[model samples]
Target chain A: MNVLLPQPYLLFLGETTEPGYAKTAFGLRDWSPQRCLGEFSLPGATVSTGLPFLTPVQARNAGARAMVIGVANAGGFIPQTWIGALLEAMQAGLDLVGGMHARLRDIPVLRDAAMQYGRRLIDVREPPAKIPVASGRRRTGRRLLTVGTDCALGKKYTALALARAFQAHGEAATFRATGQTGILIAGGGIPMDAVVADFAAGAAELLTPDADPTHWDVIEGQGSLLHPAYAGVSLALLHGSQPDVFVVCHEPGRDRVLGHPDFAVPDVLDVIDLTIRLGSRTSPHIRCAGVSLNTAKMDTGAALRLFDRESERLGMPVGDPMRGGKAFERLVKACLA
Target chain B: MNVLLPQPYLLFLGETTEPGYAKTAFGLRDWSPQRCLGEFSLPGATVSTGLPFLTPVQARNAGARAMVIGVANAGGFIPQTWIGALLEAMQAGLDLVGGMHARLRDIPVLRDAAMQYGRRLIDVREPPAKIPVASGRRRTGRRLLTVGTDCALGKKYTALALARAFQAHGEAATFRATGQTGILIAGGGIPMDAVVADFAAGAAELLTPDADPTHWDVIEGQGSLLHPAYAGVSLALLHGSQPDVFVVCHEPGRDRVLGHPDFAVPDVLDVIDLTIRLGSRTSPHIRCAGVSLNTAKMDTGAALRLFDRESERLGMPVGDPMRGGKAFERLVKACLA
Candidate 1:
């Protein structure tokens, strides 16, 4: 179901040591800064979103309507340690928002507290009750999906940036979020990963339904096609979204697939080629528009040169949305084209 | 959780006119005849399993331990009209078995009746609660999967035949079911389609875990790689099963994907190639051993001739599992090789 999250969030990063786990908080801070009031973290949590650290009461007083549980932990479970903080947030006059696999209402104490406080406990990961199987009918509107060479790349960032760029160019565009972080940022989306396997493609279709001919649904892609564990989700999204143009998201010099030691991250060209080959099952004219290089780990001068070299070599736009400049502008133009 | 079904089931076709909807009954009669006692259906049901029709009382008296809801109607819901017959079956001292998306227990009347009668209600479509994400670790056993050009071909039949053939040749083999019908016949399986999208591959891994190096897991496949709606489940099974050899199951006369008129059934070669390309991420040595031709609609003479021609063209064994002969034997041998 499309979750209508209350506005102005206080991101809750509960006892998470890894910065990677706190990506949800950082994503909101980076992409939807206006929606975020401040950050809240439990004791010993090393990660920070760089936003002002505010307690629930303080953030609520500052007009934060909800406290978003922003740490995407390994198992997507609500840790027992975080229960008190969640209850406290409810007591402090804020609704609770969660994107984890675990439901916020499932926690009895938190559920009771939310009920007592008359607060909403919105779970974004829960899919709608009745998603039909995909029709395989070609949708009318244009779509640009940002696929990835591996997980946790720049796919979401690229889609958000492209959607913004399209709007700046006076084009009708919408960022179709497919994951928890993206959904939280965009305020509503199908958590494609959480949907039943039978309805993965169907959910994608629902997320980006037939829009105006000139409108572009910039869908945020999921797992890599070469990823052994998640290629199914990726393929489902590819066929269902049926993107006319796609951007390959990759991280430079990241040789191995994250969490999968035996597998190597696929080349950007390989990702592009495979996406087109499989995505053509639905969108016959699907083509790679660009490469979204996640240059967050690379030196600026090196990243710039790599983008140029890759663009020339691949004959496509290669740019980092996080490092938007002339290259990103060209990438945006290519997507629109 | 693995289901332990009570043996010798009475196939229940509940007012189904279309033979296609009663495929589960037909499939059971064809593949697991020994486990079936007789057929039962509501009044006005045109479909039959060719077994002697018996009332629940007669079937129960005839040694039927369970009444299997055998009509796989659209939407996988138990029709309201069939509730009286189901309650009657329970009263007649038979446990109810269902593979529909709608849980049998969810029907309050039937749930209460089942509880009062002390009869088990088995819902095979429900997946296990603790399916982990795929580790992508190469498992020990040899696996042979039957892939399809489209849905409802002979994927399950091919896998069942191959598993039997492997056992006949003094090999250690197991038929692994991935769908509701397959699970019912096999008495257990992870309903791959019912699993959360994030854990599809993982559930598959659980379905076919590490085994003896010489053992073979003959995995029943699901949808086609080119199928718009169900390809996610197909890809997940492929990646998770990591089949060393796969048989392409295709219906000879069908041109379009079932229920999706806009999409043509993918070529067997394309299915093979795509399965290999995507499947290689998990099973690096994955390859197609042969083709399983569903030639039920063709005359015997034409079917044989066509098998030989396609075998020659594809440079692999081609046979109809239902029409087992030298061709089917060759296909089985090639799978072992």
Candidate 2:
């Protein structure tokens, strides 16, 4: 579903203390800094975007168009306690933009206040009304998908970085977002997780439609094929994308699937093998380009050595997109090739 | 989602002329005959369930408690012309049961009439309000899933037949439905297709929870793993079911996927291999029990010969459930073992 969010958003961090929960706010601040005015938070929220702190009234005075819900909790619900701040945002002449599983319009008070203040309440997570089943027909365009060994990895960052890299090389490319944070960053995208199971692949197909043969759609993936909770979504995204090439994103030292303790994180080689096995059903020439390693927690020397070892072991480029270097450049080159 | 569908249904074949479109009605008549009272249709509808035809008032007088929308088109929509008959059925004191993409309660006139008459309008395709992501933790009890090489081959029928066979052998078994027709026949099930993409597998986990060690849940599968349009749903069902044993369902001489002319029907062996490869992620001991052949279009002699040939080639029992012969009995024996 495409959304037209008013620019210069005031990020709302509602009672979130963990930096992980405030990833959306951080993501926008990092990627779309020009569009982010400042940050707003509830009383107990300790997380910050490192941007100027602004309340709804201050944000509105400073030309902020909307207050974007910047924290993601489990179940994607809008907590009852957050309602007052949301209403105040609308009262202060700012639109409310949410990417949660729950609809802002579903709350009676919020809906009434938005109408009373003549402010728009945009729910970015809502999918399109109609999405047909995937046709599996090969479309024009070279595409690359960033799959992961587990959820909450750097799939979105890798895709965004790769898309930028392709543009730096003077190529036609677009960053196709699939998840909520990515959707907010890209300004418009289908929330694949919110779509009906039968139409998931179709929604992906719609998200990245036919483009010029040289145009590269660096599609951000969701979940993981090895993830116990969300393999279906991953598979759907994989099939619908039919990427000519794919990159595996992984975080070092993660032994188990996030939140799913019963399942072990799959080997990167197994992920590549399975991706090729299933992805080839749609794109006959689907192949892995390289690995996008998340080395945020690693020391520079150790991360470099691990990258070299992994590259030698897997016979492909391995690099952290966040720490762009020769390795990242090589990975980017492989994606284009 | 479990539903208490008022039994003794007046099957409403709304403006349906082709028998293919009325598979839901035919399924109920054939499988759950005790719950099906009589058939009802619009003025010019030509299809019949080979049961007595009754109008709304006649059906109510004949002790029909519900009017089940029995026709399924491409989009699962209720036609504008058919709304009159649905309203009439409600007015006649019969609860309206529908398994379509369109909710019966969404229609203002029908909703008003249902409230006025104190009747229920049940939309069976709606998923539960909350579903957790799959844990991928193994549950107790045996599971036998019937997967297919293409859509509408006999996955549901094979599952239903196997459930009956297990009971006949003095074993506890339940037919777990995943589609609308199967849900109506079994009286309750999660419509895998209707669930959100991220929760498809999770919903399947909810469908067949832990049971007694000896009990078997015979799950009716959805689309084919090789099906371009629906492989995601098929994979979700496969992973979530984590079947101890699976039966590959295929129709002889079928060359292409239904409704998808661009893709060819996959070989049964490929389906078995892929199922094992993916299903093994969740079900470590997953094995192909046998093959369920749909020989509805083949002559008896030809069907028998094909079954024998396939059994020899696959090194497993192969039989058509509709033909309860020695081959089918052998297949049933293998399932129990």
Candidate No. with top DockQ: 1
Q: Each prediction's DockQ?
A: 0.87, 0.76
**Residue clash pairs of candidate 2:** none
- For model 1, the superposed segments whose C-alpha errors exceed 4 Å read A14-21, A40-63, A72-76, A79-85, A91-93, B14-21, B40-64, B72-75, B79-81, B88-93
Q: List, residue by residue over A1-337, the lDDT tens digit for candidate 2.
A: 4666787899999999899888899999988898899998888888899999988999999999999999988878989889889988999999988988788899899989988999998888888788989999899999999999999889999999999999999999999988888888988888889899999989889988999989999999998887777888889999998899999999999988898777889999999999998888888999999999999999999999999999999999999999999999999998887
Model 1: lDDT equals: 0.90
**Lowest-sum lDDT 10-residue window in model 1 chain A:** A1-10
True contacts kept of each: 0.89, 0.71
Stretches of model 2 off by over 4 angstroms after superposition:
A14-18, A42-46, A54-63, A73-85, B14-16, B42-46, B54-63, B73-75, B80-84
Model 1, span B1-337: residue lDDT tens = 5656887899999888999898889889988899998888878988888899889999999899999999977888888898999999999999999988789999999989988999989898888888999999998989998999999888888899999899999999999998888988887888888999989999989999889999999999999889999998899999998889999999998998889988898888888888888888888888889999999999999999999999999999999989999999999899988
lDDT tens string, model 2, B164-239? 9999999999999888888899888888999998889999899999999999999999998777768888888988
